[model samples]
Target: MYHVVIGVDDDVEHALACVQGVTNLPGDAAEKEVTLVHSFTDNPSGASATQIHSVREASEYLEDHGIDYDVNESSGDPAEVIIDFAEEEDADLIVTAGRKRSPAGKALFGSVTQSVILNTDRPVMVTGTARGSE
Candidate 1:
């Protein structure tokens, strides 16, 4: 079985889309396992609304497709957390969302997706933002 780690955030649609993309990849869907990971920029007492919604949506989709998966959460740098988790899990692939941001904004604030992609040796699949998101 191949282990796959997918990074999720407040954007439920983008997160779900990335998961769906995995199943569509060139391979037997049954041979892949998914791990939904959330890296909280700000530490919260409990599960945030976005995290709950994202995980719920992902779980439902995985369940419907009879896929084995689990949810993971960590607090700190988003890119660092995701990369560390992927390494710990010995994942074969890492999926993340590429937010809809202008080039200037990305240059100013930096990008978690970019950081992860640059740092990790494993392949990364970055799903673009949904059509309507800002």
Candidate 2:
């Protein structure tokens, strides 16, 4: 019974693809538990309501597959929230989308996937989409 945790962002297609890949993995389909996580930074400027709805939509996608999972939402730096949630849930695998970014974008914004890879002791699975696919 592996605990698979999928991190969802604003990209719905990428998120759905990531979930599909995980569910298709051997033994994953039989697992009774999974987790869908979405994290948002608490910027005073506010965040999109659509982003919150995206998380719910992701959870619904899992349900449609007859897979059981817990849906989570949090406010903070994305990387921190993801790492903390995985640890709290004792996840066996953490899955997320991988997007290539310019060196400047990486340096200034910092990638949550990169941070999670560095910080977590647990195994991480990243699904990459084609450039400009989203």
Candidate 3:
């Protein structure tokens, strides 16, 4: 089985992008084991990852697409949570989304997607774009 970690935020579009990334995986969808992770970057109320709309939407999409998955919720830095979870799971692929940011932009905002892509030894598949043209 191919272990895949998909990191999603509250954004539904971004979550769909991650789902699309999984859809592009080779072989059968049944061969993939997916774990959807969401980090509550600033959850004062403490929420479950399953409560996030994007995560729910992605789960539904995956179900309809014949993919099986599970959800994980965590609290902390988004990038760190994602990276650590991926490592713990020994993921074969990491799926995520990020807005297109220039060197200056990224340096200023510190993109989670950028960090995951750069820090992991596993293959990464990124989907969607802020501009949709980049």
Candidate number achieving the greatest TM-score relative to the actual structure: 3
- State every prediction's TM-score relative to the real structure: 0.88, 0.82, 0.90
Model 1, 3-118: lDDT tens digits are 88988887778877877877667767688899988888876567653447877887777777777888888888989999999999899999998887799999999999999999
Candidate 1, residue 106: how far the Cα is off, in Å = 0.6
Sort by TM-score, top down from the best? 3, 1, 2
Q: Residues 1-134, candidate 3: write the lDDT tens digits.
A: 89889998988889987887787778799899899999987887777889889999889878988888999889888888889999998989888997877899989889988889888888888888333311
Error of 1 at 105 (Å): 0.3
**What TM-score would candidate 2 get against the native?**
0.82
Clashes of each: 0, 0, 0
- Model 1 segments more than 4 A misplaced: 48-51, 129-134
Error of 2 at 26 (Å): 0.9
lDDT score, candidate 1, position 61: 74
lDDT values for all models:
0.83, 0.76, 0.85
Q: Please tell me which model should have the higher TM-score, number 2 or number 3.
A: 3
Evaluated at residue 102, the lDDT of candidate 3 is 88
Model 2 RMSD in Å is 3.6
Error of 2 at 37 (Å): 1.2
Give per-model CA RMSD. Answer: 3.2, 3.6, 3.1
